[model samples]
Target: MRLKVIIPVVLISLSAGVLAFTKLGLSDDPPGRYEVIMNLVGQMLKEGHYQPKPIDDAFSKEAFNKYLRSLDVEKKFFLKSDIDRLAPLSTHIDDELKGAQLDCFRNINTIIKQRVAEASAIYPAILSQPFDFTKEESVVLDVDKVEFPADSVARYEAWRKMLKYRTLEKLTDLQETRDKSREDSVKNKTDQQLEAEARDKVKKVYDRYFERIKNRQDDNDRFSLYVNAITTTMDPHTDYFPPDEKRQFEEQMAGKFFGIGAGLKEEDGKIKVLSIITGSPSWKEGHLKVNDVIQKVAQGDKEAVDITGYPVEDAVKLIRGNKGTTVKLTVKSVDGTVKVISIVRDEIIQEETFAKSAVINGTHKIGYIYLPEFYSDFNDRNGARCAADVAKEVAKLKAEKVEGIILDLRFNGGGSLPEVVEMAGLFIPEGPVVQVRSRGGDAIVLRDRDKSVQYDGPLAIMVNEYSASASEILAAAMQDYKRAVIIGSQQTFGKGTVQRLFSLDDFYPVKDGQSLGALKLTQQKFYRANGGSTQLKGVSSDIVLPDPYYEVSERKDSDALAWDEIPKSNYEIWSNPVNTDNLKKNSEKRMANSAAFKLLNENLATLKKLEKQESYSLNLATYKAEQKVNTAALKRYDAVNDKVKELNITSMKVDLDKIGSDTTKIARNKDWLKARTKDIYLDEAVNVMNDLIAQTLPKMQRKQQ
Candidate 1:
């Protein structure tokens, strides 16, 4: 992985909440907080040759207050009052910093600097920590530890062992397969004989251990832990790219970098192919299929190396280099035969995260708006604002005389908080949209100062397991104000915390007067009006739907912050004549009859069964028997593909090879992407609105008569 070097700037007062200070007292000229801040700024400008605006006392105080408010655990997570208390040292530091005392300022700066060093030094150690499986049996640890949960630690170690064993097993199986192929070819085998012999040999090779650990609980636990560890460091956005497989993460976030235009992921100790880009080299090759496990990766002229325990980032670095380079991956087919395939790297651009609108057929035309993320170019003033773009989409829909709107925030992981608040304002009359409480119990209610509702009609917000941060805030507000009906999966990804990145390089003069350092810190917590923090316990939906996440896992399932409540503020609910109960009933009836819905339920059942297996034997005979069962299941699944195709659904195009190879679950995420595109949930939501119109319109007609 190529690390980008960023010049650090000294930590000077940058916002309203940060305290400022001058020289310590007792001198003829006692330096004030502002003067102290100015000195730091001057040093950064002179030493680092970096220019930054000087923050006034007001801005510093506000920013500081915001950061403090985020640390109030009781306010964010639903911890008991006693848990809300900060360590005495932290409290003292907060008080001193807020007071802007020069001595205190220096003390706080020293602590912050120490933390930066600790974080940087610990980063590498974190990656190398040996996984210990026994720790998973312990029950004393809290489920919400952001760093390492004992169960996860144990699970990760177990997974590492199992993966290593699986790698060796695969190599043995491959050698056997090659030997059989060579023997059959030399035994007067015709072309047809050779092909049949090869296929059978591969099938037998894979069938050996296919079912041995298929869908094991430990497998799932380990994969989830690995993903969490990589994501725990850096800002929430920076992820570790594993070496050999998984394509979904890259395609969905970074657009594209290099290697085959395929998404990959490790699920249950097997490499699962996700998706193949439409025009990528992989798509053209047609050799790689979704769900294929990547057994090994090799550079040009190097012996294939098993990358079972390699970190995702290291794997990605090796796979992705300058475009046009060829990388070889040894992939295990679903039937269990291995083949070495080569792919050329290319760029995959994301053109999907754009404003898309649709008009739903209803008594009152319903406007549909999907905002993927709050993306913007920080360097450009006129860069796109997802919120602003969404507002415009709503306006356009209103112009078309639509009576209601559905804002799809299904997989939106959140970007900018301000944008969400602004977007919420576009729907309701001016009022408090959210409340923010700092460490000192200081509460600031953010309101929509603008009184006009951009398009008040009827509103519904759609979300799922992936909706987080700002998405949670928006959903909570809509739920609080009764502005919209929240619908979808059990709950969203519970991540309500806020973070800020600090450049450590600016803290002190370069040690040798040379390099710079940087750090990202978790600073604040976001709360919903009515005093409920959306931290670990995400906002619940008014109406629930059958989603895979509901049965398998949820935001709260991971090591997450707890849920808590605070004092409620006076807020008014929106007045609407629609009958919510009736809407729910109608949706329930529709879902019961949908074929797609039934299929989803069946798949969920199988997934649950797979998630429960705990132990597996290393015996070869047992492994081979397990492989046969898995082969049968795959064949059954393939048989159903014909049915899926017959449905003629645009989203039902299943290319097993592509889906199997994608590690990011992007291909299987079809269920999610399909839910977003041909949104059955949205379809149900629209029906609810139509029913509302039907009931209300008749009553209005009667009144008029």
Candidate 2:
């Protein structure tokens, strides 16, 4: 189980900061603008908190150089001339930043507007030109070049435009290809008719693209650009929040949001249902499923509006409404068949965010504590301390006399660092838990101040690829201390950098004099005492479990930061050493013989094969074929449930409602046990713990005898 960190207030502060920046009133003239910009830059350079290194003239220059290098034409996407034109401006920006001059804002705004105009003019030409890849000389620059800019806004906008144009160009090409295919399919068409059809198709494609570009020019793009500019100056974590997005950000951090009870993303030019919240109306109706693409949305009894190629925000607006209103969605499943689903808008309560626990086995009573996030309300001092709640659960488990514990951290993305440190301390006696290295070469060892270990017995931590940040810190600490057996998936999410938010309003003057800009700046790097940086190389499990991630994905293979090394620190190992090799062998043997494990492996294999599929045609035969494959996958999943019944495992009951609301009470009441009897991982963990106990308990008992 990986831990997820929640930074609720940060998002609010970021939004406030952005508003401040946009509202800042610097000056009417360019020199006065430069002065204002310089003053702002100087203040940030001197006082802005950063997770990486502190901002300085030298640091700014180095970053600027990196930005310039990234713009080389021989690079993957950017042109060399762009870098050449931008590099010299770095010094002015750096100086302005160093001096805290308000005038720098005007200078930056002017340069950005100019560069964007240049890029916009060149964009059509770049798209129209044909790439002669076969010509060896044509591919001029290496893709690995880096470019850094001192003016954060200019640099970010340039990259954003570059990427956006590339995406648009690719999408246009796809549309053209589809159009040509349709034109060719028309039977017995005259030359004139074919020409007309081709022209019409081209016109439609152009219109669609034009609409998309126009929509992108709206406030969303402006807000996004402003946010990115602020983030680039600070650490990546700090971001300016637009007022419109504040509510959504709050919902995300709180693990709850008011909407249509569905997660949406653009897929294949259509709004698709990524996941329906577990308790939402859609999930309850069982009409919406993953991979279902939404085609249209209609208000109560209103005509459906075709939403193909619609911007995500616009689509979201159509889907979201005040509670009690009905919204109808037309969806196309993976099979290419369409269906209509009507759901009333309502508050979606996220059960996964709350504290949930499960008992592993009836007799051994190994407790499973799943803390999704460290979420406390800003209004309350102890509102969202997940660690404290978990501690209370641990007390209950101890009273029930559980033999061991499994801390599930699979989807935990991380939350509060302090909460994580305190949680880690719960398992081990007071000691240094993690090491933080600052930019100025200062190293601090964060220790668990608690005098006593909450649960000193055998422990196991279950994590997956999604586990990140504070979760990684706790897991790394546990691994270092040898206090818990790390299990499941591959390596956890490798986000090791810390971030701090700064208000841009405090520096730059806003035109409106009402808004502020906030930057989430990366300040420091976290490291395990053993010396490996968790930045991109997340912690590897001690006892690797059979998971879909192994076949479908690898942690290091994902798009993440590069793994780098930092200085090592002296720290003590907290737990007695166990033979990891023996543990692995034991687990492997048990899994090989277990029928449940075999079934799980077969299901995972089928899932992997299905996941490889990408394209689907509109033809009926092709759609049916796709449906057959999907049906087969569904059957396989259903078969697992039947297999559970065959095993006669009383704990494998399918009634979710039977599971008590109070997880702690469920752990106590042995009669209502369901998960323990059939849980393969818990059974295995118990066997391993029992073996260890058998080996060591006799020595202590012999003295008493």
Candidate 3:
């Protein structure tokens, strides 16, 4: 995250019910509040975005389609006729963004409200009749695989197929239970009886879902949706934070959430799990994952609330509660399996987030350091910083007489920019770590001023798709300097663009000081010291280990900034560099022969196939047969690389003493080490370290002689 400036930005055009502000003072009556927000956001994006695309017909078409998708992702509500009527505004959106008229969003808002009413009546009516499970029909849940219905009749049929798919899904589960359970309540149920029950369950869920949609479809909600669509079209990171979200951002609920420790994002009106904080409740629970769709949230034994179509901030509010309180989440996994996960709310343990190291004993004494995120407390100057903690950890590992060190940045999503520059300094001599280029400015090098090197040993940095920004900066610097062996996923998370929030309130004065919300604008881009921008093409690893979650990387998104290069910064490579070609060759040979890697790759392929399987058969036998293959594949992949061989990992005596009598920290420390013990990547990293150590030993012997 980049440092944000909250000052008022007096741009060319600003308006609302209030007087319009431009070079020529107060203009006549402008369009309503919706148009005003769009214009301001449009102006700000053009002014601040690193590579702002012209808001032409292409941008308008993309924005228009994205907004419709965001509105009804399932293709359940709007008919093709509705879309056809609204199609003219698709090209007109560019005009709307420039303050011509907000007919696109305004008209869509009117149509979506009417369609929601129509859908409310359609689903239950379809569920009223019994579905024929023996029918040889299938339904595709993926909206891209299907199109909007042509008319009211086609819309009703579409509704029926979707409901039938849900009913078929429930029926399969019920049948499975009936076949396995010995209890008469379940055992005595007939096939017909189970089908009826499935419909009942489907109806129950849709009932709550529709009720939620009706409650949340106010004018403000629709406008927020429209504004967000416009912002996100520029890039995935650029976003419009409505008033509630802005409040949460100001409150910094990200650090001190009193709920399950899973971060969520609103994707096409569906709340999807973004990242689960390590050592948090969700991570410890081990059920919630990175891409799970949260269907509903329930507290205690009360009725569950359908969170679909609800903004992420609202869903988060439902999830957060008093510590120790239980929040049951009904989530659908990426494999199309749905289940309820109960997680207790707890505050994040601060120590768990700090840099921690352990000794890995083998042929070569190696040190393993885990830094979850590059954390820093902005308010307190004396507060914890990752650079300081990592320096201390390196020192600890140095005391242990470690031959080499491995810094695990696998899941680090980046933090303070200053911290990364300083952390990069720890390994190599004073140099430029990363380059930053603001919109309409020359690229400036951010350097580590201190000439002192902290740990000059056989160093290896581990990364995955989750690593980003500051993590990429450090990794890229090390890779460019040939200071460390880069290992893990194909590339790091390419979130190179820097973002800052601009206050809409600063632009427009509100009565009673009510919030006008803020827009998170991408103002800068990051470049590696080698001149290549780590924009869409992230820092590629020296050794590419296949990551199962590779689909979640930045390149998967169409709107990510394109990869570009600048003039390379002047710097010296490491004086004594490890032979990377030999190291890579040896590692590749090991992975090629390893059974675990082979099976893991095979299972990744299986999952990829299953991911593309959005179509489900309505026939019970056919559906069950297809799901059986999916279930088997998912189960195999679940524990594919659970453990290769547990490594001899132990905590440092000093760190153990620091834990002292604190049972909570002691327990957490145990869990932390226990998780890494089975890590195949870490295991391979140690092997790679041994190779580097082998390569370095002869040189050391020659030096001593």
Candidate 4:
């Protein structure tokens, strides 16, 4: 388990001298905008949400608890007395929302501001000197499981233990480095020197982190978080996006946005270009490379503004511009070379986000299609559609005459519902794919009117815990029809509800040029053609594989909607349904005998043990011994990626032609092919396709006889 560092508010400053608590403004009068938004939100939730719960005392309390948890999940800031003081507002939120009175929010926000100011003074005092790592005490990593402090003294004590634990970790890391160096040469630094250096490293990390928090957060940001807390209480997917956030959301959904298209991240107080999106201005110019530190930005031909110490978010504002606009970036390459690169911003379409297929050269030629999401262009009817792209991939694979096809939806979190319907129609004959039920309405069966089968060969849908929404719809449809062998996790992410994005401005007219946020409301819930809702209980796989990495499921979310059933739609099952029992038995027998799977199980057991051991000893020797044991256990699973049995993945001719003149595109495609060679999941998926081919071959022979 990774121990999370809790940065006290006093740690907001770099040095001890700057730890001053400022008084917060706590006005009882609510802002007029708050009243307007509150009334709008209340009306929207009642009319727009799929299943609107009454805005009663129970809902208010739930929202109140959720808001506090969102603000401080680790129980770090507020004291027990503070919570008791605000306890009355837990049930009063119901009345407040109805009356457009934000007294609760005002009170809570004011108290948090005061708490943050007070916390700014504790950390600098604590980190002024070295901590005793030899102290025979333990620190809990899962602080959420613990209770809040009773008073200010208790809170300070909690912060002390947290800082000490972090300092100990840094100390251990430095000591290990010093020990490793001692193996080759004589060590110069003593334990005290190493401890001091370790403390400095921890302090710098927290300093940078706090600096960003201070620089980015404002009253409006706090208000946005407060609004989101209320919206998300309805469901995890429901959210309130402010004006700027709404624009970002639209850009994400559009798949193409007007910008320089360089992915940026902050590292060591510098904004570094992580990657350049292919087909973007930065990629075409061929100057900005990954790991290049951006120092300054100039819009058009204006004087360059120094962005050296700017946060990644702030640095992005300088880089992004209107389409066809020129932006100059002064960057420092990894080799210590400084150069100014000019790039004209344009529409950057993420091709990799679309559908792509490859031929897996093995015992059985398998067509592998990896759809990252069910992307669809809502802005243009003729724009990119995942369903159409998938159909194209199927055609490309068919041209190669592959024996089997594997649709990988392992990490696909789903997108357009209509695209999923069309994609599902590609496998089986046209029929009802899924049923959607709106609030206070009957289930409407969404069917594929197209009767033409695209690729009717042996198919296997690869899914995991993250394969959700549209992914689940497709998987559930295929499973219902016995069209494909669903393999991977026990069940997919159980997100069955559909959300409609609504602009807040449309609901209430604002003449003051003030910006109102957008709301993502759950308007409908989808059910399988078999009548079973895929809400809390997602689509289960036929051959459940070991997923030791991510323990994600709908049940983990406390506010998830309950699973239920509607009337089963009248639909015909596939004429030749899959023999799932035989397939499951064979897969299970093979898994029980496989070395890789045995190691995977061992790794899962180790992880489970680590999850249970949340407390860590402050003693250096004890901590090192525990880490050593965990590291040794992890070594067994190191060969998991190396044991990839020949998956000869090759790009299609169309893709090869597209990448012919572009070196970056060629390199990216080559990397994609190389990555597939080491994919353990893909290896198993190919094996599953092989099993399906083998099973179908005997049946074909009998049919001939």
Number of the top candidate by lDDT?
3
Error of 1 at 179 (Å): 18
Model 3 weakest lDDT span, ten residues long: 11-20
TM-score of 1: 0.53
In model 2, the Cα lDDT at residue 237 comes to 48
Model 3 per-residue lDDT tens digits across residues 1-705: 111222244221111112123321123563455665777787777656667899899998998999999999988889999899998889987787776777788799999999999889888888988888888998888888899988889888888988898998899899999999999989999999999999999997877677667757688978898888888999998889877677455335123446788879977668999887767999899999999999999996789998877877679878877679999999999999999999988875445667889999998899999998877655446667889989999999999999999999998988677788889999988889998887667888888788889988899999999999888999999999988989999888898976666667766544455666888777778799899988888889998888876677888989888888999999999877767899999999998998888888889898887788877788888989888998888787767556387899999999999888866567778998998888888888999999999998888788779
What is the C-alpha lDDT profile of model 2 across 1-705, one tens digit per residue? Answer: 111112222121211222122223434442333244334434443344433345555555554544333222323223345446655555554554544342333443444445544544443443343322222221111234334333535444444434333333343344445556656554344444433343444445444544554444343444345334433545434444543354445445555545677878875456888776656778777888888989889998999988887877878877876678888999889998999988887877555575555555544456667777665333246444577778977876776676777777877887666677888889887777777765555567777888798887777777777788888898888888877778776677777876544544554545555434344455567778677788877888877666655522223433233566756666667645444666778877877887767877888888877766543332333444556777777786656544442111222232235554755334533443454455455455566655544544554467569
lDDT of 4 by residue, 292-313 (tens): 9998899988999877557887
Q: What is the C-alpha lDDT of each candidate?
A: 0.53, 0.58, 0.82, 0.80
For residues 1-705, could you state the per-residue lDDT of candidate 1 as single tens digits?
111222342232222222212222223453442333234332322223111223334434433333332332112211232223222323332233233343323333343334333333332333233322223231212223322213434434433444433432453355456556646545454434434443444334333223221222132223322222322311243222222223333233333456677767755444557667777878887888888877677776678766553434444545665477777888888998989988877765443564556566535676777778755433235656667778777767777777777788888887666677888899778777877654334556777788888876777888888888888889999888877788887778777665443332333333344322222234456688879888777888877787666532234333234566777767777755345576778777877776656665666666566556544434445545656665565554444333332211221222234346564545435554454444455666666666666755666668669
Better candidate number, 2 or 4, judged by lDDT: 4
Top model by TM-score, which number? 4
Count steric clashes of candidate 4.
Answer: 4
The superposed Cα distance between candidate 3 and the true structure at residue 520, in angstroms, equals: 2.1
Candidate 2 Cα outliers beyond 4 Å, as residue runs: 1-25, 28-217, 222-240, 244-351, 506-517, 550-571, 575-579, 594-705
User: What would the C-alpha RMSD of candidate 1 be, to one decimal place?
Assistant: 14.7
Ranking by lDDT: 3, 4, 2, 1
Cα error, residue 519 of model 3, in Å, equals: 2.1
